[model samples]
Target: MVKKNDQLIVTIEDIGANGEGIGKYQGYTLFIKNTAVGDKVLVKVMKAGKSYGYARLMEIIEPSAFRVSPICPIAGKCGGCQIMHLDYEKQLEYKEDKVRNCLTKIGGFDKITMEPIVGMDYPYYYRNKSQFPVGKNKEGKVVIGFYASRTHSIIDTDHCYIGADVNIKIIKFMRSFTEKYNIEPYDEVKHTGLLRHILTRMGYKTGEVMVCLVINGKDIPHKNKLVEGLRKIPGMKSICLNINTSNTNVILGEKVIKVWGETYIEDYIGKVKYRISPLSFFQVNPIQTEKLYNLALEYADLQGDEVVWDLYCGIGTISLFLAEKAKKVYGVEIIPQAIEDAKVNARINGIDNAEFYVGAAEEILPKKHKEENISADVIVVDPPRKGCDQKLLDTIISIAPKKVVYVSCDPATLARDLKYLHEGGYELKKVRPVDQFGHSVHVETVVLMCASSEAGKC
Candidate 1:
């Protein structure tokens, strides 16, 4: 009987995927944002349905023990971090439970081994990459920051709690530079102005930084002055421009123009040096990336003589890691630029056993297996959010690698794909969730599966 604008007091019992609190009142489920489990809160129903409804948190009558004061003053208003209000320990626990629940409820795994989640000792300031949108506020001054939750409206802030500390300096420089030149901030509504977004990437180990300004036009006014100002900053290695003349939500365009310095910045992930360009799909967190990849390598369990196939290998991050232990590794990716980067990374690292191919994994893997009779003893797949394609799954089953290591970003799609693999005669062995994104609801999980015949043996 609950309708819109109904006021009620509810006890939060669970947290949803997006970090919303779930509470039940008289058999009706209410989802409220900015509230955590074990909290008793007053809420007003925003959109009421028959069995479930969305509500807005009015007041917290009692706070959860796991809840903590977020380091960022604008944590609740900014869309960057979802679960920052929750303690880091509880955040790890929730992510572990999320993976377990997905496997049990969605994958139908009645019994499965799940290891404890690997978390960072210090989660804040871990992000090596940050993108800020540029726009004008109500007062007609240039504003730069992340968008508010679920809205395109930018929330002006000098610093992001989770991003690299250098981001603040960069933002400040841009604010002043824009003001001095009277540069126009891109207006998404009217499709006018010039600068749209600013992207910055840092090499956590190398202390190298790259800045790419996304603009609505091909060039920026007073580009030399902008470059000079940016070069004054420490570790400034690359300054570039990304032209996206089209009116679209997508951040980057196909063309990238180097304004100053190098076109790419070099970084290391476990001794493997990688040259990261502005368009590269590198993991944002370097500390946790090492842990995550090391876990994947352990799951791969290469004996120094195994032939491994790395599917959807971006810039050869995981592929090169596996190649260090495996006798030979073949990496397949759909993006040509990524494959080129992978090749360059392998050569730069002096790794001769790794090879890169440019094509869709589903199409290329099967063709290679058929034409070259290339069979792998172990297979590693780091698929996108949508998970592996059915054809790729079928090919893996047919190849029958002794060990199949799957690195997933989405738990739901992962569960669905795991079900497909399990039905195809693979046994789920070990599942470990890694907290790559600390406060965000997103988590990365690495799973180990073995052929049915070699289940317990592995």
Candidate 2:
């Protein structure tokens, strides 16, 4: 029987949702971290259960053929890139299987048409945005990096292979600047200190950068010097401060004070210009995002005569793209600020047919459909990881749009909601998984579903 601290050898058979290796020991499943599929490794049981247990990899007896030496030195220690050790091609295959498995097993789809996954040409340095937690190590020295796996403990690192190259310089500067100014790193346990995190956003195409310092207090000690130093960095267009005096794990606060330069940075996703602020919910991967949106646009199959509904549209990123081909587009988001940005994005792009609304998609959409009698020919939903609410799903069924394009980050939730819609007279069509966050277990999938009654018309 498996018990805590029991040493055993197991051959990894599969990868879990969080990139953990799943292997069986005498019919009992064990989940081991920092291990990959096709790997034979010695593991120590951490927490043993009846059917399954958690284990820690002690030694890799035989490395998998799909396993590769991670480019980042601290990739294993840092939780930012979970599957960096896996081959890129294998990673894509895993993601594709992940989506397919969810649809077949969870969504209960018998035979669903699936398209090949969209992957980045060059996967490294694709992240345009990075959030580095500022904390002190056990040795009492300041460290800036990501947290360890499932823990708040920060893993010190000088660079990340998946993030922008400028992030290295930013980290170096912050390390020295904090040391020189004696800036205290926030200790979440004690809830003290000034600097909590360093947030950065880079426009891959525009060459514009925005740096926002997340502080535990209202202001910084040496504000002018900090701004001067950060401004010296190339492509530095915006410098801002986010104040979160509360004792919480949340990174950014509601209040944002621009210290210098522009309030927001400009970026392009397939010719659609967007103004990104410190708090905006923009996709971190720009290159893959353009491809993802293009796939969504194709799935939407707009013909310039259909009125489209874009639910949970952040900064009108997808809405504007659809607006270019649709007769009119209505975007709904819970964040008022994102709605405002969406309106601004539409105006800047000279897209007059798109309209923005602020409120929960579930509530606002049902209300608009009932009260305003706003009907859509095609409905595009890019909901959060939780997927669309039941109320909104019912509304979509009642309205019976000709097509429903779902963009999801979580396959499980996507399958759950797709099942609900599939039962609601929507026929599942093409489904494509997009590798938005390479080296991570997370994947973005775009699915197209047409109303069963209107399938012939669509």
Candidate 3:
């Protein structure tokens, strides 16, 4: 029944919360991509494991009701997004169920309850920010696009389903700049190039956009010429240069120097204006972020007088929100630039009750607790895909805040963090999954945790 690279016909039994197809063949697990949960397909095993195997669907014998035609031509090959073929309503259910299952199956919480997932009003074009890598096409024409998820290669794109028109135009505009300079693409193996990345951020309501040009070297030849062209972009907040020469392929280039235009982008939410710099981390979707943050503030049960700690608070979005109602809010982050931006944002909004600290959550939180000898009523963590560090979870337990709000972009990491928190005597009282990016597997989750002694089981 099982052999190396054996072809097997199997029905997709279920879907993991991450949108990975779930199937089993003779007690061996198989994860196949681009297939719906109800589809029966013949798959060729790509890699076999002791317990689980990776596969690709070679033949679809029976199609599932959830399956729909994918609009993107490179949907399967590009690896940018899966579940694009699934119905929108079904996608919502899958994300919600994925969060619930994680609480029950992984966290082992008996009384866990979940609210309905928050569906986006306008899912497509929900992302107001996007970063595209600039490279060359087959004809050697300058092409800017996202990387192919499957191959880690460039997927030459003109207009992404999620990016706004302003960003698309900018990308198209970059072609001439790259061509004029004859900037060679940075090959990971060879490691030679001038250009690296083009990052763009736009505000849905304010109509302000920020674009940062990242290069592999500090002194780009004919930098003045490039600056002239980049500044010509209408409504461009910043057109600075980032110098990144590391062996790693991380999009961010170190040592950003102001070439022309402002160095930061101004993004507005409600009545508050937040300035986002080249290195600052902000939510790509501004429309849903308002909903996301407000819901989180409600879940935190903030009372304007309570002390709130926003961990990994990039540019202090949540801390500023809480500052409106809280007596004092402190945001701790490792990126000092982001902390500086947070400080500026607070000052800009006349929010004197908020402050920013620069450091990792796992280290800074405990130090603040011990050195300051203070306890917080609430804690909010909006961590990267890697989730909260274990040490930070331990510190959170020691501090024992009455309320904890966790915002995550990845479900698997969120679930892992939840398990750790559950072990630390926190119960998952409520959770809501919000889909900010449509036609993609991306989901944003907000979870509220309370002290088990005061809260009922669940």
Candidate 4:
């Protein structure tokens, strides 16, 4: 029970995952949002408990030297960007520290030295994709913005600090769209509306963009109008409509129909151009994606005529990339649509050395291991947030490749898989943290694994 008279001056000891100030009040830990480390501030207790207290910053008596003015005015209030207040370099440092801490503190595994965090060369224009939630403000005007942190409330941001120039233009363009079409905002309580989300992804190299509009119900009365209207917008490579009727918070919902333009997007990655369908998963930031894949290939240490197994290969991106470098690449995925897209992507790209299968990694990999007369020289696994299942990990251990390049989006899960792999005889060579998605807590990392106990680890 915090009172009016309670005042405390404390230093922010660390930064939390969602980019908050981590410290202690008395013997309990406290997490203060929108705060930086090395900042000495007086906080007013908002809610108090025996273990910890929630407090608001009364005054920053001593501010950190590293603290800088946040670029986005709605940064603290909006839940979009987290590290805008901290300098770009310092943000990378914080990410590195966070990864390392997750490895040691959470996973209880060590020995692999994490390389310096790779930051986006262009921070502000790095985000190729951004989703804006649509809502109606108190005045009943259409409010388009992101969800406030940890709440159902909305934060209407006129300007997103990290989005590309084209993205911002698209958002502004969409405002006219919502206004002209009279598209109703989705009401969470009543669960009725027309528009749900605006998803946009831009290609850095090709200058092409794929815009997807997620709607509420099946009866898209004016979808054709929307397609025709949005088609007039400049720089839009393709536009799609994905109808999501489920009462869930999952983004992209159920991809119902592909209206106007093409059902997919065409973008160039390195020398290859990929056909990205709405359901297909691709990295949001295109420029940083190039760097990330290049770094992963470098870490994989691929040799000519080597067979590489790409597990959880969405749309066979890694397989296509590694095709020319390796003798053959076998990509495995669970999503049938994605696998079909992958095969088509490979065929269109003239990548014959890559073959894709439609099944889960934990299901398909072991059968292939038994039937195939050959083992892989290199194995690359990029799983979703849940990480590798124990069965898949066992398969990986059994068919231990000469080198393993595991790409992870979740550090905690990555650390868990790493601990399992480390126990199974693979040695952690290095971890390279790539900031493909900046301003968010999510970190994309590439960990190289080498056989430590001789050539028989397989």
Q: How accurate is candidate 3 locally (lDDT)?
A: 0.80
Per-residue lDDT of 1-458 in model 2, one digit per residue for the tens? 89999999999999998899999999999998888899999999999888999999999999999999998888887888899999999999999999999999999998989999998899999999999999999899999999987899999887888999999888898899999999999999999999999999999999999899999988888878888888888999999899999989899999999899987999999989999999999999999999999999998888789989999898999999888899989999988999999999998999999999998777777788789888889999999899988988998898889999999999999999999999999999899999999999999999999999877766
Worst window of 10 by summed lDDT in candidate 2: 360-369
Put down candidate 4 lDDT per residue, 285-339, tens digits, no spaces.
Answer: 8777777888878987667789898999998877888887898899998888889
Give Cα-based local distance difference scores for all models.
0.94, 0.92, 0.80, 0.79
Question: Per-prediction TM-score, please?
Answer: 0.99, 0.98, 0.91, 0.93
Residues 1-458 of candidate 3: C-alpha lDDT, one tens digit per residue: 56568999989988865577888887788998888888999999998878888898899899988998876777776665678878888888888877777667766656766778888775566677787887766686666787776565788877777677787678766776677678776665567777778888876677777777777777667777766766676676677777888978688875888777777778787778988777887888888888888889888877667889999998998889888888789899988888988999999999998888888877877788899876688999999889888888988999898888999888778888898888788878888888777767778899998889757622
Error of 3 at 453 (Å): 4.2
Superposed model 1: Cα runs more than 4 Å off: none
The per-residue C-alpha lDDT of model 1 at residue 22 equals: 98
Model 1 score (lDDT): 0.94
Backbone clashes in model 3, listed as residue pairs: 111-458, 112-458, 304-325, 304-326, 304-327, 333-359
- lDDT tens digits, residue span 1-458, model 1: 89999999999999998989899999899999888899999999999988999999999999999889998999998988989999989999999999999999999999989999999979989999999999999999899999999999999988998999999999999999999999999999999999999999999999999999999998999998899999999999999999999989999988899999998999999999999999999999999999999999999888899999999999999999888899999999999999999999999999999999999877887788889998889999999999998999999998889989999999999999999999999999999999999889999999999999998789
Error of 2 at 64 (Å): 1.3
Better of 1 and 4 by lDDT: 1
